[model samples]
Target: MPKPNKLLIVLAFFSIYVIWGSTYVLNKTAVAELPPFMLAAIRFLTAGVLIFIIAAVTGQNLKISRKQLINTGIAGFLFLAFGNGIVVWALKFVDSGFAALEISAQPLVILLLMWLIQGKKIKPMSLIGVFLGIIGIYLLVNQRQVLNQDDSYIGIIMIFFCMISWAYGSIFVGKADMPSNYFVNTGYQMITGGCMLVLLSLIFNEEWSSPLVWSPNVQLSMILLIIFGSIVAFTSFNYLLKMVSPEKVATNTYVNPIIALFLGWYFLDETVTLQSIIAAVILLSGVYFINTSKRKVMLNRFGLQQIQNKLRKNKVQ
Candidate 1:
Protein backbone atom coordinates (compact mmCIF):
# COMPACT_ATOMS: atom_id res chain seq x y z
CA MET A 1 0.00 0.00 0.00
CA PRO A 2 2.94 2.29 0.73
CA LYS A 3 5.27 3.71 -1.91
CA PRO A 4 8.38 1.66 -2.61
CA ASN A 5 11.65 3.32 -1.61
CA LYS A 6 13.55 4.55 -4.64
CA LEU A 7 16.89 3.92 -2.99
CA LEU A 8 16.06 0.35 -2.07
CA ILE A 9 14.67 -0.30 -5.52
CA VAL A 10 17.83 1.01 -7.14
CA LEU A 11 19.95 -1.12 -4.84
CA ALA A 12 17.88 -4.18 -5.66
CA PHE A 13 18.24 -3.51 -9.36
CA PHE A 14 22.00 -3.20 -8.99
CA SER A 15 22.12 -6.42 -7.02
CA ILE A 16 20.41 -8.38 -9.79
CA TYR A 17 22.20 -6.63 -12.64
CA VAL A 18 25.74 -6.84 -11.30
CA ILE A 19 25.69 -9.69 -8.83
CA TRP A 20 23.65 -12.06 -10.97
CA GLY A 21 25.64 -11.14 -14.05
CA SER A 22 28.80 -12.23 -12.32
CA THR A 23 27.17 -15.52 -11.43
CA TYR A 24 27.33 -16.89 -14.98
CA VAL A 25 31.08 -16.83 -14.93
CA LEU A 26 31.21 -18.12 -11.37
CA ASN A 27 28.88 -20.99 -12.24
CA LYS A 28 31.00 -21.88 -15.25
CA THR A 29 34.07 -22.02 -13.07
CA ALA A 30 32.44 -24.18 -10.44
CA VAL A 31 30.91 -26.61 -12.92
CA ALA A 32 34.28 -27.08 -14.56
CA GLU A 33 35.34 -29.15 -11.57
CA LEU A 34 32.11 -30.03 -9.80
CA PRO A 35 29.18 -32.11 -10.99
CA PRO A 36 26.50 -29.74 -12.22
CA PHE A 37 23.43 -30.82 -10.29
CA MET A 38 25.39 -31.62 -7.16
CA LEU A 39 27.13 -28.26 -7.29
CA ALA A 40 23.81 -26.45 -7.65
CA ALA A 41 22.32 -28.56 -4.90
CA ILE A 42 25.10 -27.72 -2.50
CA ARG A 43 25.20 -24.03 -3.39
CA PHE A 44 21.46 -23.58 -3.00
CA LEU A 45 21.12 -25.74 0.09
CA THR A 46 23.90 -23.86 1.83
CA ALA A 47 22.50 -20.50 0.80
CA GLY A 48 18.98 -21.51 1.87
CA VAL A 49 20.10 -22.70 5.28
CA LEU A 50 22.11 -19.57 5.87
CA ILE A 51 19.20 -17.38 4.80
CA PHE A 52 16.86 -19.27 7.09
CA ILE A 53 19.27 -18.70 9.96
CA ILE A 54 19.48 -15.04 9.15
CA ALA A 55 15.67 -14.78 9.06
CA ALA A 56 15.32 -16.54 12.39
CA VAL A 57 17.94 -14.33 14.01
CA THR A 58 16.23 -11.25 12.68
CA GLY A 59 12.90 -12.33 14.25
CA GLN A 60 11.11 -13.11 10.99
CA ASN A 61 8.34 -15.71 11.12
CA LEU A 62 9.21 -19.02 9.48
CA LYS A 63 5.70 -20.43 9.40
CA ILE A 64 4.01 -21.33 6.11
CA SER A 65 0.72 -22.96 5.21
CA ARG A 66 0.74 -26.26 3.31
CA LYS A 67 -0.55 -24.56 0.20
CA GLN A 68 2.14 -21.92 0.39
CA LEU A 69 4.75 -24.62 0.73
CA ILE A 70 3.36 -26.45 -2.28
CA ASN A 71 3.29 -23.31 -4.38
CA THR A 72 6.77 -22.30 -3.35
CA GLY A 73 7.95 -25.85 -3.94
CA ILE A 74 6.64 -25.82 -7.49
CA ALA A 75 8.25 -22.44 -8.04
CA GLY A 76 11.48 -23.72 -6.54
CA PHE A 77 11.46 -26.76 -8.81
CA LEU A 78 10.90 -24.67 -11.89
CA PHE A 79 13.25 -21.83 -11.00
CA LEU A 80 16.22 -23.48 -9.35
CA ALA A 81 16.01 -27.18 -10.06
CA PHE A 82 15.22 -26.87 -13.75
CA GLY A 83 16.12 -23.28 -14.62
CA ASN A 84 19.38 -22.95 -12.74
CA GLY A 85 20.40 -26.58 -12.63
CA ILE A 86 20.24 -26.81 -16.40
CA VAL A 87 22.16 -23.59 -16.81
CA VAL A 88 24.86 -24.95 -14.53
CA TRP A 89 24.98 -28.14 -16.52
CA ALA A 90 25.12 -26.21 -19.77
CA LEU A 91 27.99 -24.07 -18.56
CA LYS A 92 30.11 -27.18 -18.64
CA PHE A 93 29.82 -27.11 -22.42
CA VAL A 94 28.93 -23.51 -23.31
CA ASP A 95 30.82 -20.32 -22.76
CA SER A 96 29.39 -18.33 -19.88
CA GLY A 97 28.98 -15.24 -22.06
CA PHE A 98 27.19 -17.15 -24.75
CA ALA A 99 24.99 -18.76 -22.13
CA ALA A 100 24.18 -15.36 -20.66
CA LEU A 101 23.21 -14.05 -24.10
CA GLU A 102 20.81 -16.94 -24.58
CA ILE A 103 19.31 -16.52 -21.15
CA SER A 104 18.58 -12.86 -21.90
CA ALA A 105 15.66 -14.11 -23.97
CA GLN A 106 13.83 -14.69 -20.70
CA PRO A 107 12.03 -11.32 -20.75
CA LEU A 108 10.47 -12.03 -24.10
CA VAL A 109 9.40 -15.48 -22.95
CA ILE A 110 7.93 -14.03 -19.75
CA LEU A 111 6.00 -11.43 -21.72
CA LEU A 112 4.55 -14.03 -24.04
CA LEU A 113 3.64 -16.31 -21.15
CA MET A 114 1.94 -13.46 -19.30
CA TRP A 115 -0.04 -12.56 -22.36
CA LEU A 116 -1.11 -16.14 -22.97
CA ILE A 117 -1.96 -17.06 -19.38
CA GLN A 118 -3.32 -13.75 -18.05
CA GLY A 119 -4.80 -12.48 -21.34
CA LYS A 120 -2.73 -9.32 -21.18
CA LYS A 121 -2.63 -7.73 -24.60
CA ILE A 122 0.81 -7.29 -26.07
CA LYS A 123 1.39 -3.81 -27.37
CA PRO A 124 2.51 -3.30 -30.97
CA MET A 125 5.91 -2.06 -29.85
CA SER A 126 6.25 -5.03 -27.54
CA LEU A 127 5.44 -7.31 -30.46
CA ILE A 128 8.12 -5.61 -32.53
CA GLY A 129 10.54 -6.14 -29.67
CA VAL A 130 9.73 -9.81 -29.64
CA PHE A 131 10.40 -10.07 -33.38
CA LEU A 132 13.74 -8.33 -33.00
CA GLY A 133 14.59 -10.64 -30.12
CA ILE A 134 13.87 -13.71 -32.25
CA ILE A 135 16.02 -12.34 -35.03
CA GLY A 136 18.80 -11.61 -32.60
CA ILE A 137 18.64 -15.11 -31.23
CA TYR A 138 18.85 -16.51 -34.73
CA LEU A 139 21.92 -14.40 -35.41
CA LEU A 140 23.55 -15.31 -32.14
CA VAL A 141 22.92 -19.00 -32.54
CA ASN A 142 24.11 -18.96 -36.13
CA GLN A 143 27.28 -17.27 -35.04
CA ARG A 144 27.86 -19.87 -32.34
CA GLN A 145 27.50 -22.90 -34.68
CA VAL A 146 25.92 -24.63 -31.71
CA LEU A 147 24.70 -27.49 -33.87
CA ASN A 148 28.20 -28.39 -34.97
CA GLN A 149 29.26 -29.29 -31.48
CA ASP A 150 27.18 -32.26 -30.33
CA ASP A 151 27.69 -31.59 -26.67
CA SER A 152 27.40 -27.82 -27.02
CA TYR A 153 24.11 -28.05 -28.91
CA ILE A 154 22.62 -30.07 -26.12
CA GLY A 155 23.79 -27.43 -23.70
CA ILE A 156 22.26 -24.71 -25.81
CA ILE A 157 18.93 -26.51 -25.88
CA MET A 158 19.11 -26.97 -22.14
CA ILE A 159 19.72 -23.24 -21.63
CA PHE A 160 16.78 -22.48 -23.90
CA PHE A 161 14.53 -24.64 -21.72
CA CYS A 162 16.09 -23.00 -18.70
CA MET A 163 14.86 -19.64 -19.90
CA ILE A 164 11.33 -20.94 -20.27
CA SER A 165 11.33 -22.60 -16.88
CA TRP A 166 12.70 -19.49 -15.22
CA ALA A 167 10.22 -17.21 -16.96
CA TYR A 168 7.29 -19.37 -15.95
CA GLY A 169 8.53 -19.58 -12.37
CA SER A 170 9.01 -15.82 -12.23
CA ILE A 171 5.43 -15.20 -13.34
CA PHE A 172 3.99 -17.96 -11.16
CA VAL A 173 5.60 -16.64 -8.00
CA GLY A 174 3.93 -13.28 -8.50
CA LYS A 175 0.52 -14.94 -8.17
CA ALA A 176 1.44 -17.81 -5.84
CA ASP A 177 0.40 -17.77 -2.21
CA MET A 178 3.85 -17.44 -0.69
CA PRO A 179 5.08 -15.92 2.53
CA SER A 180 5.03 -12.15 2.91
CA ASN A 181 8.61 -12.26 4.06
CA TYR A 182 10.61 -12.31 0.84
CA PHE A 183 13.60 -13.79 2.58
CA VAL A 184 11.55 -16.58 4.07
CA ASN A 185 9.92 -17.38 0.77
CA THR A 186 13.19 -17.33 -1.10
CA GLY A 187 14.83 -19.57 1.49
CA TYR A 188 12.08 -22.12 1.12
CA GLN A 189 12.34 -21.98 -2.64
CA MET A 190 16.05 -22.51 -2.52
CA ILE A 191 15.76 -25.40 -0.10
CA THR A 192 13.06 -27.10 -2.10
CA GLY A 193 14.88 -26.57 -5.37
CA GLY A 194 18.16 -27.72 -3.91
CA CYS A 195 16.56 -30.91 -2.67
CA MET A 196 15.16 -31.54 -6.10
CA LEU A 197 18.56 -31.01 -7.66
CA VAL A 198 20.07 -33.48 -5.24
CA LEU A 199 17.37 -35.97 -6.11
CA LEU A 200 18.14 -35.49 -9.80
CA SER A 201 21.82 -35.98 -9.16
CA LEU A 202 21.10 -39.26 -7.44
CA ILE A 203 18.83 -40.41 -10.24
CA PHE A 204 21.43 -39.59 -12.85
CA ASN A 205 24.26 -41.10 -10.81
CA GLU A 206 26.27 -37.90 -10.85
CA GLU A 207 29.58 -38.42 -9.16
CA TRP A 208 30.83 -35.78 -6.79
CA SER A 209 34.51 -35.46 -6.08
CA SER A 210 35.35 -34.80 -2.48
CA PRO A 211 35.30 -31.13 -1.51
CA LEU A 212 38.76 -31.60 -0.05
CA VAL A 213 40.01 -32.32 -3.56
CA TRP A 214 38.51 -29.20 -5.12
CA SER A 215 40.83 -26.45 -6.28
CA PRO A 216 40.94 -23.21 -4.36
CA ASN A 217 39.47 -21.37 -7.34
CA VAL A 218 36.50 -23.75 -7.48
CA GLN A 219 36.00 -23.42 -3.73
CA LEU A 220 36.03 -19.65 -3.93
CA SER A 221 33.63 -19.64 -6.85
CA MET A 222 31.23 -21.92 -5.00
CA ILE A 223 31.33 -19.66 -1.95
CA LEU A 224 30.59 -16.58 -4.02
CA LEU A 225 27.77 -18.35 -5.89
CA ILE A 226 26.10 -19.35 -2.63
CA ILE A 227 26.57 -16.09 -0.72
CA PHE A 228 26.23 -13.39 -3.33
CA GLY A 229 24.53 -15.08 -6.28
CA SER A 230 21.83 -17.11 -4.55
CA ILE A 231 21.43 -15.36 -1.19
CA VAL A 232 21.97 -11.70 -2.00
CA ALA A 233 21.14 -11.31 -5.69
CA PHE A 234 18.20 -13.72 -5.78
CA THR A 235 16.64 -12.13 -2.70
CA SER A 236 17.09 -8.70 -4.25
CA PHE A 237 15.36 -9.95 -7.40
CA ASN A 238 12.37 -11.40 -5.50
CA TYR A 239 12.13 -8.21 -3.44
CA LEU A 240 12.11 -6.10 -6.61
CA LEU A 241 9.33 -8.27 -8.09
CA LYS A 242 7.21 -7.27 -5.09
CA MET A 243 8.15 -3.59 -5.47
CA VAL A 244 8.01 -3.04 -9.23
CA SER A 245 6.44 -4.31 -12.43
CA PRO A 246 7.89 -7.66 -13.52
CA GLU A 247 8.85 -6.09 -16.84
CA LYS A 248 10.87 -3.43 -15.03
CA VAL A 249 12.38 -6.00 -12.71
CA ALA A 250 13.48 -8.01 -15.76
CA THR A 251 15.58 -5.19 -17.24
CA ASN A 252 18.53 -7.00 -15.71
CA THR A 253 18.49 -8.95 -18.96
CA TYR A 254 19.87 -5.85 -20.64
CA VAL A 255 22.68 -5.34 -18.14
CA ASN A 256 23.59 -8.92 -17.23
CA PRO A 257 24.85 -10.10 -20.63
CA ILE A 258 27.21 -7.16 -20.87
CA ILE A 259 28.68 -8.01 -17.49
CA ALA A 260 28.82 -11.71 -18.27
CA LEU A 261 30.55 -11.11 -21.61
CA PHE A 262 33.16 -8.84 -20.10
CA LEU A 263 33.78 -11.11 -17.13
CA GLY A 264 33.94 -14.21 -19.27
CA TRP A 265 36.47 -12.57 -21.53
CA TYR A 266 38.61 -11.04 -18.81
CA PHE A 267 38.65 -13.93 -16.38
CA LEU A 268 38.21 -16.98 -18.55
CA ASP A 269 39.74 -15.77 -21.80
CA GLU A 270 36.58 -16.72 -23.66
CA THR A 271 36.35 -15.64 -27.25
CA VAL A 272 33.90 -12.91 -28.26
CA THR A 273 33.77 -12.56 -31.98
CA LEU A 274 32.60 -9.43 -33.73
CA GLN A 275 29.50 -11.33 -34.79
CA SER A 276 28.78 -12.07 -31.17
CA ILE A 277 29.08 -8.36 -30.40
CA ILE A 278 26.63 -7.53 -33.15
CA ALA A 279 24.25 -10.19 -31.90
CA ALA A 280 24.55 -8.77 -28.41
CA VAL A 281 23.60 -5.38 -29.74
CA ILE A 282 20.61 -6.75 -31.58
CA LEU A 283 19.44 -8.85 -28.64
CA LEU A 284 19.92 -6.14 -26.04
CA SER A 285 18.22 -3.57 -28.26
CA GLY A 286 15.19 -5.85 -28.43
CA VAL A 287 15.16 -6.16 -24.65
CA TYR A 288 15.43 -2.38 -24.34
CA PHE A 289 12.50 -1.93 -26.69
CA ILE A 290 10.34 -4.44 -24.84
CA ASN A 291 10.99 -2.81 -21.46
CA THR A 292 10.61 0.81 -22.64
CA SER A 293 7.46 0.14 -24.71
CA LYS A 294 5.58 -0.94 -21.60
CA ARG A 295 6.75 2.17 -19.75
CA LYS A 296 5.56 4.34 -22.62
CA VAL A 297 2.14 2.67 -22.54
CA MET A 298 1.89 3.21 -18.79
CA LEU A 299 2.87 6.87 -19.11
CA ASN A 300 0.33 7.39 -21.90
CA ARG A 301 -2.41 5.88 -19.79
CA PHE A 302 -1.48 8.12 -16.83
CA GLY A 303 -1.44 11.20 -19.06
CA LEU A 304 -4.84 10.36 -20.53
CA GLN A 305 -6.24 9.83 -17.04
CA GLN A 306 -4.97 13.26 -15.97
CA ILE A 307 -6.50 14.91 -19.04
CA GLN A 308 -9.89 13.21 -18.42
CA ASN A 309 -9.73 14.24 -14.73
CA LYS A 310 -9.19 17.88 -15.72
CA LEU A 311 -12.12 17.81 -18.19
CA ARG A 312 -14.39 16.19 -15.59
CA LYS A 313 -13.51 18.91 -13.02
CA ASN A 314 -14.30 21.67 -15.55
CA LYS A 315 -17.70 20.11 -16.40
CA VAL A 316 -18.54 19.73 -12.70
CA GLN A 317 -17.61 23.35 -12.03
Candidate 2:
Protein backbone atom coordinates (compact mmCIF):
# COMPACT_ATOMS: atom_id res chain seq x y z
CA MET A 1 0.00 0.00 0.00
CA PRO A 2 1.09 3.56 -0.66
CA LYS A 3 2.18 5.75 2.22
CA PRO A 4 -0.46 8.05 3.72
CA ASN A 5 -0.27 11.82 3.29
CA LYS A 6 1.17 13.22 6.51
CA LEU A 7 -0.04 16.77 5.89
CA LEU A 8 -3.62 15.75 5.17
CA ILE A 9 -3.69 13.56 8.28
CA VAL A 10 -2.50 16.46 10.39
CA LEU A 11 -5.14 18.76 8.92
CA ALA A 12 -7.86 16.22 9.48
CA PHE A 13 -6.74 15.68 13.06
CA PHE A 14 -6.76 19.41 13.67
CA SER A 15 -10.26 19.75 12.28
CA ILE A 16 -11.75 16.94 14.36
CA TYR A 17 -9.83 17.65 17.56
CA VAL A 18 -9.77 21.43 17.84
CA ILE A 19 -12.91 22.28 15.92
CA TRP A 20 -15.05 19.65 17.61
CA GLY A 21 -13.72 20.57 21.05
CA SER A 22 -14.47 24.24 20.56
CA THR A 23 -18.01 23.34 19.56
CA TYR A 24 -18.88 22.44 23.16
CA VAL A 25 -18.23 26.02 24.20
CA LEU A 26 -20.09 27.36 21.17
CA ASN A 27 -23.08 25.14 21.82
CA LYS A 28 -23.16 26.19 25.45
CA THR A 29 -23.11 29.86 24.51
CA ALA A 30 -25.82 29.54 21.88
CA VAL A 31 -28.14 27.49 24.06
CA ALA A 32 -27.82 30.10 26.78
CA GLU A 33 -29.41 32.70 24.54
CA LEU A 34 -31.46 30.61 22.10
CA PRO A 35 -33.80 27.74 22.74
CA PRO A 36 -31.79 24.53 22.49
CA PHE A 37 -34.01 22.67 20.02
CA MET A 38 -34.46 25.70 17.80
CA LEU A 39 -30.78 26.52 17.84
CA ALA A 40 -29.78 22.95 16.99
CA ALA A 41 -32.42 22.72 14.26
CA ILE A 42 -31.28 25.87 12.49
CA ARG A 43 -27.60 25.08 12.80
CA PHE A 44 -27.98 21.58 11.37
CA LEU A 45 -30.49 22.62 8.70
CA THR A 46 -28.18 25.35 7.44
CA ALA A 47 -25.19 23.00 7.50
CA GLY A 48 -27.14 20.24 5.76
CA VAL A 49 -28.24 22.61 3.01
CA LEU A 50 -24.72 23.91 2.50
CA ILE A 51 -23.23 20.39 2.35
CA PHE A 52 -25.98 19.20 -0.01
CA ILE A 53 -25.24 22.11 -2.33
CA ILE A 54 -21.55 21.31 -2.26
CA ALA A 55 -22.21 17.65 -3.04
CA ALA A 56 -24.43 18.54 -5.98
CA VAL A 57 -21.96 21.09 -7.32
CA THR A 58 -19.15 18.56 -7.06
CA GLY A 59 -21.20 15.97 -9.00
CA GLN A 60 -21.39 13.42 -6.21
CA ASN A 61 -24.16 10.86 -6.57
CA LEU A 62 -27.10 11.70 -4.30
CA LYS A 63 -29.05 8.57 -5.06
CA ILE A 64 -29.77 6.00 -2.37
CA SER A 65 -31.91 2.88 -2.04
CA ARG A 66 -34.93 2.90 0.29
CA LYS A 67 -33.12 0.72 2.79
CA GLN A 68 -30.17 3.10 2.79
CA LEU A 69 -32.45 6.07 3.34
CA ILE A 70 -34.23 4.39 6.24
CA ASN A 71 -31.00 3.37 7.90
CA THR A 72 -29.48 6.79 7.40
CA GLY A 73 -32.56 8.48 8.81
CA ILE A 74 -32.52 6.21 11.86
CA ALA A 75 -28.84 6.81 12.45
CA GLY A 76 -29.34 10.53 12.05
CA PHE A 77 -32.21 10.63 14.52
CA LEU A 78 -30.26 8.65 17.07
CA PHE A 79 -27.01 10.57 16.65
CA LEU A 80 -28.13 14.12 16.10
CA ALA A 81 -31.66 14.43 17.43
CA PHE A 82 -31.17 12.46 20.63
CA GLY A 83 -27.40 12.51 21.04
CA ASN A 84 -26.57 16.11 20.20
CA GLY A 85 -29.91 17.75 20.81
CA ILE A 86 -30.15 16.47 24.37
CA VAL A 87 -26.61 17.56 25.11
CA VAL A 88 -27.43 21.06 23.91
CA TRP A 89 -30.51 21.09 26.08
CA ALA A 90 -28.55 19.78 29.05
CA LEU A 91 -25.93 22.50 28.63
CA LYS A 92 -28.41 24.90 30.16
CA PHE A 93 -27.64 23.17 33.45
CA VAL A 94 -24.14 21.78 32.87
CA ASP A 95 -20.78 23.36 32.19
CA SER A 96 -19.44 22.83 28.71
CA GLY A 97 -16.20 21.33 29.94
CA PHE A 98 -17.96 18.89 32.22
CA ALA A 99 -20.27 17.90 29.42
CA ALA A 100 -17.33 17.11 27.17
CA LEU A 101 -15.67 15.04 29.85
CA GLU A 102 -18.84 13.10 30.42
CA ILE A 103 -19.29 12.46 26.75
CA SER A 104 -15.76 11.07 26.55
CA ALA A 105 -17.06 7.95 28.26
CA GLN A 106 -18.85 7.07 25.04
CA PRO A 107 -16.49 4.26 24.08
CA LEU A 108 -17.05 2.47 27.34
CA VAL A 109 -20.79 2.78 26.99
CA ILE A 110 -20.58 1.51 23.45
CA LEU A 111 -18.54 -1.46 24.56
CA LEU A 112 -21.03 -2.34 27.24
CA LEU A 113 -23.93 -2.02 24.82
CA MET A 114 -22.23 -4.28 22.32
CA TRP A 115 -21.64 -6.86 24.99
CA LEU A 116 -25.17 -6.72 26.33
CA ILE A 117 -27.13 -6.24 23.14
CA GLN A 118 -24.94 -8.01 20.59
CA GLY A 119 -23.41 -10.61 22.90
CA LYS A 120 -19.88 -9.59 21.98
CA LYS A 121 -17.18 -10.89 24.26
CA ILE A 122 -15.45 -8.29 26.40
CA LYS A 123 -11.73 -8.53 26.90
CA PRO A 124 -10.35 -8.53 30.46
CA MET A 125 -8.63 -5.16 30.09
CA SER A 126 -11.75 -3.69 28.53
CA LEU A 127 -13.81 -4.93 31.48
CA ILE A 128 -11.36 -3.23 33.82
CA GLY A 129 -11.63 -0.08 31.76
CA VAL A 130 -15.37 -0.20 32.11
CA PHE A 131 -15.08 -0.48 35.87
CA LEU A 132 -12.65 2.43 35.97
CA GLY A 133 -14.97 4.53 33.83
CA ILE A 134 -17.80 3.90 36.22
CA ILE A 135 -15.62 4.97 39.14
CA GLY A 136 -14.66 8.12 37.30
CA ILE A 137 -18.25 8.90 36.58
CA TYR A 138 -19.15 8.34 40.20
CA LEU A 139 -16.37 10.66 41.30
CA LEU A 140 -17.52 13.38 38.98
CA VAL A 141 -21.19 13.11 39.78
CA ASN A 142 -20.86 12.66 43.51
CA GLN A 143 -18.85 15.77 44.19
CA ARG A 144 -20.26 17.75 47.05
CA GLN A 145 -21.22 20.63 44.81
CA VAL A 146 -23.03 18.39 42.36
CA LEU A 147 -24.76 16.50 45.11
CA ASN A 148 -26.15 19.71 46.48
CA GLN A 149 -27.89 20.57 43.24
CA ASP A 150 -30.76 18.57 41.76
CA ASP A 151 -30.52 20.20 38.37
CA SER A 152 -26.85 19.36 37.97
CA TYR A 153 -27.62 15.68 38.48
CA ILE A 154 -30.40 15.98 35.95
CA GLY A 155 -28.00 17.45 33.43
CA ILE A 156 -25.49 14.72 34.11
CA ILE A 157 -28.11 12.06 33.60
CA MET A 158 -29.15 13.66 30.35
CA ILE A 159 -25.55 13.68 29.17
CA PHE A 160 -25.29 9.96 30.00
CA PHE A 161 -28.28 9.29 27.77
CA CYS A 162 -26.65 11.43 25.08
CA MET A 163 -23.55 9.24 25.17
CA ILE A 164 -25.61 6.07 24.84
CA SER A 165 -27.58 7.46 21.91
CA TRP A 166 -24.44 8.59 20.14
CA ALA A 167 -22.66 5.27 20.67
CA TYR A 168 -25.63 3.28 19.42
CA GLY A 169 -25.91 5.47 16.37
CA SER A 170 -22.23 5.08 15.65
CA ILE A 171 -22.38 1.29 15.93
CA PHE A 172 -25.48 1.18 13.77
CA VAL A 173 -23.85 3.22 11.03
CA GLY A 174 -21.09 0.65 10.70
CA LYS A 175 -23.59 -2.11 9.84
CA ALA A 176 -26.27 -0.14 8.02
CA ASP A 177 -26.32 0.46 4.28
CA MET A 178 -25.42 4.01 3.27
CA PRO A 179 -24.57 5.95 0.14
CA SER A 180 -21.10 5.27 -1.18
CA ASN A 181 -20.31 8.97 -1.17
CA TYR A 182 -19.59 9.94 2.41
CA PHE A 183 -20.40 13.59 1.78
CA VAL A 184 -23.81 12.78 0.35
CA ASN A 185 -24.51 10.36 3.19
CA THR A 186 -23.57 13.00 5.72
CA GLY A 187 -25.78 15.54 3.99
CA TYR A 188 -28.77 13.23 4.17
CA GLN A 189 -28.11 12.47 7.84
CA MET A 190 -27.91 16.12 8.71
CA ILE A 191 -31.03 16.99 6.75
CA THR A 192 -33.03 14.18 8.31
CA GLY A 193 -31.74 14.91 11.82
CA GLY A 194 -32.31 18.63 11.44
CA CYS A 195 -35.90 18.00 10.40
CA MET A 196 -36.42 15.86 13.50
CA LEU A 197 -35.08 18.61 15.72
CA VAL A 198 -37.35 21.13 14.04
CA LEU A 199 -40.31 18.84 14.59
CA LEU A 200 -39.48 18.56 18.30
CA SER A 201 -39.16 22.31 18.54
CA LEU A 202 -42.58 22.76 17.02
CA ILE A 203 -44.12 20.11 19.24
CA PHE A 204 -42.66 21.72 22.33
CA ASN A 205 -43.69 25.20 21.16
CA GLU A 206 -40.16 26.53 21.50
CA GLU A 207 -40.07 30.31 21.63
CA TRP A 208 -39.26 31.68 18.16
CA SER A 209 -41.41 34.75 18.15
CA SER A 210 -38.84 37.52 17.89
CA PRO A 211 -35.46 38.01 16.21
CA LEU A 212 -34.49 40.19 19.15
CA VAL A 213 -34.27 37.16 21.38
CA TRP A 214 -31.14 35.94 19.58
CA SER A 215 -28.14 37.87 20.86
CA PRO A 216 -25.11 38.58 18.68
CA ASN A 217 -23.06 36.01 20.60
CA VAL A 218 -25.70 33.37 19.97
CA GLN A 219 -25.82 34.21 16.28
CA LEU A 220 -22.07 34.00 15.93
CA SER A 221 -21.96 30.69 17.79
CA MET A 222 -24.67 29.25 15.58
CA ILE A 223 -22.80 30.22 12.42
CA LEU A 224 -19.57 28.70 13.71
CA LEU A 225 -21.40 25.52 14.67
CA ILE A 226 -22.93 25.18 11.22
CA ILE A 227 -19.69 25.80 9.35
CA PHE A 228 -16.81 24.56 11.45
CA GLY A 229 -18.53 22.18 13.85
CA SER A 230 -20.96 20.41 11.55
CA ILE A 231 -19.57 20.65 8.02
CA VAL A 232 -15.79 20.97 8.18
CA ALA A 233 -15.11 18.80 11.21
CA PHE A 234 -17.49 16.03 10.16
CA THR A 235 -16.16 15.92 6.59
CA SER A 236 -12.63 15.79 7.88
CA PHE A 237 -13.56 12.90 10.15
CA ASN A 238 -15.08 10.97 7.25
CA TYR A 239 -11.95 11.55 5.19
CA LEU A 240 -9.75 10.37 8.02
CA LEU A 241 -11.80 7.19 8.47
CA LYS A 242 -10.98 6.22 4.87
CA MET A 243 -7.35 7.33 4.83
CA VAL A 244 -6.15 6.13 8.22
CA SER A 245 -6.62 3.39 10.77
CA PRO A 246 -9.68 3.76 12.97
CA GLU A 247 -7.45 3.60 16.06
CA LYS A 248 -5.55 6.69 14.95
CA VAL A 249 -8.79 8.50 14.13
CA ALA A 250 -10.16 7.61 17.56
CA THR A 251 -7.42 9.69 19.22
CA ASN A 252 -9.67 12.68 18.75
CA THR A 253 -11.72 11.41 21.69
CA TYR A 254 -8.67 11.83 23.91
CA VAL A 255 -7.68 15.26 22.61
CA ASN A 256 -11.12 16.84 22.43
CA PRO A 257 -11.88 16.77 26.17
CA ILE A 258 -8.61 18.42 27.02
CA ILE A 259 -9.20 21.09 24.45
CA ALA A 260 -12.76 21.60 25.67
CA LEU A 261 -11.60 21.92 29.28
CA PHE A 262 -8.94 24.47 28.39
CA LEU A 263 -11.21 26.50 26.14
CA GLY A 264 -14.05 26.46 28.64
CA TRP A 265 -11.78 27.63 31.41
CA TYR A 266 -10.04 30.25 29.26
CA PHE A 267 -13.07 31.79 27.58
CA LEU A 268 -16.11 30.93 29.65
CA ASP A 269 -14.44 31.17 33.06
CA GLU A 270 -15.94 27.80 33.94
CA THR A 271 -14.78 26.18 37.14
CA VAL A 272 -11.89 23.70 37.07
CA THR A 273 -11.59 22.42 40.57
CA LEU A 274 -9.10 19.94 41.99
CA GLN A 275 -11.73 17.22 42.17
CA SER A 276 -12.77 17.87 38.61
CA ILE A 277 -9.15 17.64 37.48
CA ILE A 278 -8.71 14.30 39.22
CA ALA A 279 -11.94 13.05 37.72
CA ALA A 280 -10.79 14.08 34.27
CA VAL A 281 -7.58 12.13 34.67
CA ILE A 282 -9.36 9.00 35.78
CA LEU A 283 -12.01 9.25 33.09
CA LEU A 284 -9.50 9.83 30.32
CA SER A 285 -7.28 7.03 31.58
CA GLY A 286 -10.21 4.65 31.48
CA VAL A 287 -10.97 5.71 27.92
CA TYR A 288 -7.34 5.18 26.99
CA PHE A 289 -7.40 1.65 28.36
CA ILE A 290 -10.62 0.85 26.59
CA ASN A 291 -9.35 2.03 23.24
CA THR A 292 -5.99 0.32 23.50
CA SER A 293 -7.56 -2.95 24.57
CA LYS A 294 -10.08 -2.83 21.76
CA ARG A 295 -7.34 -2.04 19.27
CA LYS A 296 -5.42 -5.10 20.40
CA VAL A 297 -8.50 -7.26 19.94
CA MET A 298 -9.15 -5.92 16.46
CA LEU A 299 -5.56 -6.45 15.40
CA ASN A 300 -5.48 -9.97 16.77
CA ARG A 301 -8.69 -10.82 14.94
CA PHE A 302 -8.22 -9.24 11.51
CA GLY A 303 -4.97 -7.31 11.25
CA LEU A 304 -2.86 -9.85 9.36
CA GLN A 305 -5.56 -11.03 7.01
CA GLN A 306 -6.64 -7.49 6.20
CA ILE A 307 -3.09 -6.39 5.47
CA GLN A 308 -2.53 -9.37 3.15
CA ASN A 309 -5.80 -8.64 1.32
CA LYS A 310 -4.92 -4.99 0.96
CA LEU A 311 -1.49 -5.78 -0.45
CA ARG A 312 -3.04 -8.13 -3.01
CA LYS A 313 -5.67 -5.55 -3.96
CA ASN A 314 -3.00 -2.86 -4.38
CA LYS A 315 -1.04 -5.12 -6.74
CA VAL A 316 -4.16 -5.70 -8.85
CA GLN A 317 -4.94 -2.01 -8.99
| Each prediction's TM-score versus the true structure | 0.95, 0.88
In the range 1-317, model 1's lDDT, one tens digit per residue, is 34788998899999999999999999999888889999999999999999999999999999999999999899889989999998999998789999999989888998999999899998888888899899988888886455565588788888999998988888887777788878998899999999999999999899977778899999999999999999989888888877777788888999899999999999999988887888888888888889889899889999999999999999999
Native-referenced Cα lDDT, model 1: 0.89
Q: Name the candidate that leads on TM-score.
A: 1
Worst 10 residues of 1 by lDDT: 142-151
Top lDDT model: 1
Q: How many clashes in each structure? A: 0, 0
What's model 2's TM-score?
Answer: 0.88
Cα lDDT, all candidates: 0.89, 0.82
**lDDT per residue (tens digit) for residues 111-213 in model 2:** 8887887898888887787888888888887787666655888899999998888777766765667776767877888899999999999998998744466
